[model samples]
Target: MLLKTFGWSFAVTAAGLALAGVLWGWKGLAIVGILSILEISLSFDNAVINAGVLRKMNAFWQKIFLTVGILIAVFGMRLVFPVIIVAITAKMGPLEAVDLAINNKDKYEHLVTAAHPAIAAFGGMFLLMIFLDFIFEERDIKWLGWLERPLAKLGKLETLSIVVALLVLLVTAMTFATDVAHGGGDKTATVLLAGVAGLLTYLIVGGISGYFEDKLEEEEEEVEEAEEAERAEKAASGAQKGSQGATVVGLAGKAAFFLFLYLEVIDASFSFDGVIGAFAITNDIFEMALGLGIGAMYIRSLTVYLVRKGTLDDYVYLEHGAHYAIGALAAILLITIKYEIHEVITGLIGIVLIGASYWSSVVRNRREEAAGGEDAESKAEVTSGV
Candidate 1:
């Protein structure tokens, strides 16, 4: 299973490294290797979150995610998207931006870095909404019950997540985003506008996905109801045969389509920091694309692996850990607007949270097993005595 899942990722890694070596010698190969590892380390939580959404999709959409989605991630987000951002921010045409990226590496990096405030605000707000929605919604499993319980109760209030996300964006814009100590400019308006745009994108995409999901659920319920009625009629007519299976609709059509859009937007939001941070390592666009692209392939593969293996179902707290990690990343992105935080710190926070949650899940499973054993033993003893 592991080989089947990661075979393509390994192949891509080898090809990418070979290309990097050919292009810029050993140094290029090493940078690409580092960038690949960096993207994977930073995006493990993203994979977990992606798996949670991808599992709801059917086989066709899953295939599309691996194929079409990888192209969008590798080329669109890693390569073209950065150029588009540079073009828009620098008030230049796309060709000019491409020329700048290719010919004037330092200036290109500077322009991209200069656009960091808006990028951070937009990505940060989008991620903050994701984290807020996850924590606020009531779930059967609660990893951080102490905090999540109260938040889930409050989640019953309509638009509470949006209200809290907007408040955070406002405070961040007024405070850290506008701090001149980090860079010499008041970016209040820029941050606010970008943040609102991010927030709105989440709402629109998530709202449409939710609408389709509700429709899917209603259809499933109707099918089950019809099946139940059929079973009742069969039993009442002195029939002893089993009822036929009900054909349930999967998340496909418009539902899967919008959900795919939501996933891509989420992936884009997650990539903002990685794309910007790559400039710190190398100014070469091709190298960045190659390295990040390889890492993205692995992430997509891992998402599929998790869904197929039911890893999330086994480790209940894993999703919680991922969201908490996302919450931390969102806060870090907002904080980084005014302060420099190492990528190592960002990666470590995710690893630690996920690690803790996994351990907790193991402990919970053990306790349940022990309780089951005790109950079984007690019943045996009672039966023997009787």
Candidate 2:
């Protein structure tokens, strides 16, 4: 199972090391290893959250997520996205930006780092909305009842997440407004616009998935009714066939398309910190890509493993912890716009929250099992006239 699941991860890591060696020798390969560790450390929460989303998708889309999705994460976000930001922000041609990255590495890093405000605003807002939506939506299990219960009650207010996000953007923009006049070129306005773009992207992507999910539900219901009436003896098998068939045939194409896009955007948001933080470690663009690319490939494989093995179902509060970590990360990203924060601190915060939540889940499970065992024992005693 390990080989089958993580074979690609191993292959990619080997390839990354080989390519790094070829490009810049053993020293370059070592840099890639360090960068890979950094990316993995920072993105544990991302892998968990991705597993949650991937669990909801059908098999076909899950395959795309592993195959095509890895390509986008490794290439688009890790390599090309930063270059595009530099090109747009510094008003340099793509080739010129590439040249700068190669020769004038410091200037390239400066240009990319300078664009952090916009990048943070966009990614932070998107992730903040995700966290807000998760907390607000009603759930049978409440990880933190004191906090989550109140949030769920507040969720009754329509568009509450959007409203809260807008208020946050407003305050953040105003806080940074002074810097714009100090030669930051309207940093506040750029942040506001980017935040709005993030919000809109979430809404559009979510709306598309929801529409298809509803359609799939309706089709499943019809299939169930037809199966019950036509073949009562074979109802179970027939219903299974109908559901799988609907997913494979009717629901696979357009639904998977939007879901694939949604997953990609979500992955991109998670990569924002990793990409920016990489500059602090190395100014070599190819080194950053190879190292972070290997880390990203492993994350994709981890996502697939979580989905296939039903890890999310096994660990009930894992998703909650991941979202809370995301919320913290989002806040940090926005704060970084005004104050520089170390990536180590950012990564540790996520690790701590997720660890705590996992511990809580274990405690909850054991307590419930103990209670169940006592109940069973009591019933046995009464039935035996003890």
Best-fitting candidate, scored by lDDT: 1
- Stretches of candidate 1 off by over 4 Å are 180-183, 231-251
Q: How do the residues 321-355 of candidate 2 rate in per-residue lDDT, one tens digit apiece?
A: 99999999999888888777888998898899888
TM-score of candidate 1 on Cα atoms, chains taken together: 0.94
What is the lDDT of every predicted structure here? 0.89, 0.87
lDDT of 1 by residue, 1-386 (tens): 99988898989998899999998999999999999998998999999999999999999999999999999999999999989989998899999999999999989888888888888889999999999999989999899899999999999999998999999989988998766333458888888999999999999999999899888777667656765886877543323212212223344467898999999998998898889878779999999999999999999999999999999999999999999999999998888888888888888999999889989999999999999999999999999999
User: What lDDT score goes with residue 182 in model 2?
Assistant: 21
Model 1 misses residue 19 by how many Å?
Answer: 1.1
Off by over 4 Å in 2: 180-186, 232-248
Note the residue pairs that clash in candidate 1.
Answer: none
Candidate that would win on TM-score: 1
lDDT of 2: 0.87
